[model samples]
Target: MERISFCPTLAAPLNKSEVASSRNDKSQWKTKENRPCLMVVGNDSAAAGTLKEALGEWGYDVVAARNGWEALVLAGRRPVDGMLVDMDMPIMDGRTMLSELRWLGHQMPVLIMSNESDEQVHPQLLMEGAQGFVLKPPHFQSLQQTCRKGFAK
Candidate 1:
């Protein structure tokens, strides 16, 4: 499947203390370890790597899963503040993953990413418990805006 290629200038990862202090009382950005973690699920290693590095630079602790199964294991094992999932992947696609997550009572906001046009499917995805849908080649601004709103509470 085609993936978005992002060109983010690498930024330093946030230290544990920095992550702790940066979060406010209202922010849902804390995990069991008290650090915010975001899970990125996709089969595109190159894209996932770039996205993970970029999110880390922005002060988020990022974890990656090559497929839906790995993602499910990680989420079940620990806290995930949010998720950025690609629509097409091996093993399981984004829709199925989202369904399973919700069925298992995981409520963290999830955003689906795809190269497909956002004409119809996004509405259905939203009904299925997604926070939003992002078209591939997603601009950082849109991603940041969407994430901030989702994680604000």
Candidate 2:
């Protein structure tokens, strides 16, 4: 049988306290403990919303940022299990944000999402410590598998 974790509705009106309580209740659901939180960064609101939905459905706590600077701020507040960054963000590009995250001593893996999925971009991004690259309109299978592996407990 397939395993399913807790993923509340994206449009749900639950307050933060309710969500936090649910997250802490291990035995409440027959799911694993400590599902990873995801921070998604992109300038496109639509894409960000879509990914937010996907990640939420995949049973991850989802947070969306419109740019790298916002992502950085969110990342600094708490250690997230994974990140999905869009290369063309305002103020800071994906590469720059990635480097800054590294400089801040963050060891979390980053996945870049962009329109241009050049063959060399993956290698280049990886060289800067990014874990992987996901092309825009990410494949569901790839996204699920990568996130699972990225957040393996």
Candidate 3:
């Protein structure tokens, strides 16, 4: 499969072994700690890794999913304090996932990230239950602030 690169800060795409290691069952992830747990849903492994690292530096325990379906499964199994989701993903898109999350009563704050320039999507995402919309190649500081605000809700 061709690896799709999305986030601009990717230094190198994760090799197959790295990707497999990251996919180990949730038992290996530390989610029950005092730090907030966050779910990051994105198709690009490298980008998600970078984001996860940044979130870790900011004192969050992060879990990752490759698409919306995987995210829903993880959320059903465990709770996340917040989420950062890429709006355009294979299998299931962010908008649909947001709607499903709300319907299923997973009210955690979600921040939708997308590269699209559609001006109308922002408001629609908010209506669908996203706490905020973040443009692609997000500023880490801004994302941190947004996550903090989301956690406050």
Top lDDT: which candidate number? 3
Instruction: List runs of model 2 lying over 4 Å from the truth.
Output: 1-33
Candidate 3's residue-wise lDDT over 1-153, tens digit each? 755233233334323333334444446545566688899999999999999999999888899999887787677666677899999998778887787667555778998999975788888888879888778888888988887887664
Model 2 has an lDDT value of: 0.72
- Cα lDDT of model 2 by residue, 1-153, tens digit: 321212221122223333344445434333254567788999899888888898889888778888876776666555577799999977778887787677555677788888887887779889988888787788888989987876566
Per-candidate count of clashing residue pairs (backbone under 3 Å) = 0, 0, 0
Best by TM-score: 3
Steric clash count of candidate 2:
0
The whole-model C-alpha lDDT of candidate 1 against the native structure comes to 0.74
When 2 and 3 are scored with lDDT, the better candidate is: 3
Candidate 1 or 3, higher TM-score?
A: 3
Deviation in Å, model 2, residue 118 alpha carbon: 1.4
Candidates sorted by lDDT, descending order?
A: 3, 1, 2
Global Cα RMSD, each model: 12.1, 11.7, 10.1
lDDT by residue (tens digit), candidate 1, 1-153: 322111122122223233233333334445555656889999998999988987877767899999776776667665678999999998778988887677656788898999987678888999999998778877988877877777655
